[model samples]
Target: MAPCPGRVGPGGAELLPGTALAILAGALLLAWPAFLNGYPLVFIDTVSYLAQTIVPEMPWDKAPAYGPFLHAFHWRMTLWGSLAAQVALLSWMLWLTQRGARGGVTPAAHLLLCAAMVALTSLPWFAATLMPDVLSGVAALAVFLLGCARPRLSRIEAVAVLLVGVFAVAAHLSHLIIAAAVVALVVVLERRVGSALRAAAAPALAILVLLGANLAGHGRAVLSPNGAIFLLARLQADGPAAATLRERCPDAGWYLCAFADRLPMDSDEFLWDPASPVSRDADGHPRFMGSVALVPEAQAIIAATLADRPFAVLRAMAGNALAQLALPQVGDTLPDTHLALSARRMVRDGFPPRELAAFDAGLQMRGLLPEVAAPFLRPHLPVLIAAVPLALLGLARGGREQRALVLAALVAIGANAAATGALSKPHHRYEARIIWLLPLAAMLALAPRRGRDPGLA
Candidate 1:
């Protein structure tokens, strides 16, 4: 084969100059967490994922891909292997995406841009963290590869892109829907601007994998418990769903009626709190409320509320959409609960005791850190909000293929925003997963100087 066919030129087996250095630079930048903390950083969800990896059963809501990957990495006694693997895969996929973009970029430029990402954006945070958020952004690049770079791809490159996209979808339930939504948008753009089914082949196969994985892991063929309950929880937090609950509870015989008065104003708090009606049982045990018995009631409330007050639902969605558009603050790192729970899980699962000791030792070194990026990234949400549309406009100024790429990114962001922002609730981490793409798109647009004219490029 042509030495690493994924990076090979048509002329010979030799890879692009500095390609290895660029990937190494990207990987080191992404693995900064491990370098500093002696382990990968984690979110609260990370504990559940770790537990899922060691435990026999799949989590009710979590997708199965990352959990198993973590299990495989745990054999080495620390999370460094998992973090390193994540950074390497991310670096490789990013290199492929940039290579396939318009004029392509020098490997030096790629390394410099990767450094910029580490410094200027939350790229390193998600990348180094033990969560699936980083993959969501990578999936966007895969979408572009499949949609705009198909003709340029060698067979190995095509397979790599398809696998990346599929794995991205398998990482999270919302990710699968978001990827599907982007693919749908690509299909529409192709119909309007002229592409081909070849562009969608990867995404189509990804959807099949998504369904199959869900079936295998959760014993269900659904994309994800239907998302109707979460949507209902969101509406409840926004006021109208609670109003509906109060009106229809006694006669309708729904469970949430009892606690409608005590529901939290925050969508995430309400949905995730142990005492919330969605997950709590009368006997005080945690219950999986996504069962068939609860779906119809949640669906009924959603249907009635929308039918009675359509404008209210739209207004709520808009508010959350705006919130999700803003970039997450840098201070939004893992909570103490995440560390404690993760450590507990490690001990319970008989993980290497020495690794846990090292982890604890690393914790003592925490102190008042220099405040450079956090101060600026917090209040500069407006800049981040403006960047996405500007990136799309910049892409439009390029050739036809770039315009299609722009559409694909827009749809991906829009669908993700709707799903995580409105349907669930606006959280920084939700949007952070995809917001890195705006800067990436801008970079790609500027890198192609020698390509066709702005109109034809």
Candidate 2:
């Protein structure tokens, strides 16, 4: 999109024609870890998303949208193409969001912003990642831009923002909830009900995408075939499900009556560990996301827990939500743990030999990513510590545009913590995915306003 008329910057600088070079440089900087790794970063969930290519059935654990997203960006050859596309999209969001600054952020200043994030935040790690984490931030930006920066955008940019927002929300279930919250805030604060509805339409569009994909691929029109399992896992991990199970074991007539004593395991272990009752077969093998009967049982358990012990469920969820809020820190963005192993094995099994070879050759697969990532991870907390207060100040005193962006970031971060922590598990990665927004919005809020555009028309 070209720069808006009457929107002035230092020396009356503009963008589109100007920001192209900066966007390119920023994209590379955003994906710096991948450049070092010689391959795009992979996560535990990367394989499941990649599996969408070959698997006919829609997975119960994750949304069906991201596998196709990776496919669309993968260029059919190397993942660097996907990484490039992801980071470029993120860079554009950063520039466009920053462009909402009072006079507008100059390309040089925008570049400085991206550089600061690469050095001090978790932006680079996710930007280069093959998973849907980068899209989470992109979705937040899309919500802010579509909801707050729409008038400044051309019809094309608006449509582009909507499409990007769809995939960003569709990439994960938690994203959908985060988007809904941001859209609501935009409506309430900006008073642009129409704009907020348009923003809300992104999640609607994302839902349609999942329905169409499921109908075409699996001959079913369901969204998230076993979505309740995530809730069940969360409740079980949080201690409510076990209490429910203990209360009504044999009479409940559920398959889980076989294992009521093993009350509350960690959500990850319940979902992935072979010993977990949710997934453990009679033969001792850990099945993928448990048996065919698991979803219904999971749903029943979740329902029973909420109905019987609503306070316990709510308290546990509240605790998990609070835990997640405090855990947006960047820890293990690039892993050397079992998650790394999962990605490695899945890539080897699901992808072509060449793709697997390149994956295996990456810094993570070589056991070097954690060490390489440590230095970059160190400064993130300190930067976030500074950014939170700046963002708060921006929300309190900055102009409407600044307030909207900062508030959107805060709402998305809070919503993400609540959703992922309460519905899935409280992990740093869940909140870390969207935490970069704080610094980005804070910088834009504090940016200088040189020109005459006071606010939107």
* Highest-lDDT candidate: 2
Clashes of each: 1, 0
Name the top TM-score candidate. Answer: 2
- 25-62 in candidate 1: lDDT tens per residue? 78998777556655677666776677775666666667
lDDT of each: 0.67, 0.77
Error of 2 at 296 (Å): 0.9
TM-score of 1: 0.84
Query: lDDT per residue, candidate 2, 1-457, as tens digits?
Result: 2332333223322345556788888898999989888789887777778777745345656787788777777645667777888889888878767755454556687789999889988888888888888777778788887777665565666787889899898888778888888888877866656776877889889889878876776577877767777788788878878888888988998877777777688887877676887677556766664744598888888888889999988888888899988887665667656755576766666567898788878788788877777776888888899998898888778766777788888898888888888888888888788888888888777776444332222
lDDT of 2: 0.77
TM agreement with the true structure for every prediction = 0.84, 0.90
Off by over 4 Å in 2: 1-17, 54-57, 101-103, 281-291, 339-341, 345-355, 450-457
Position 190, candidate 2: lDDT: 62
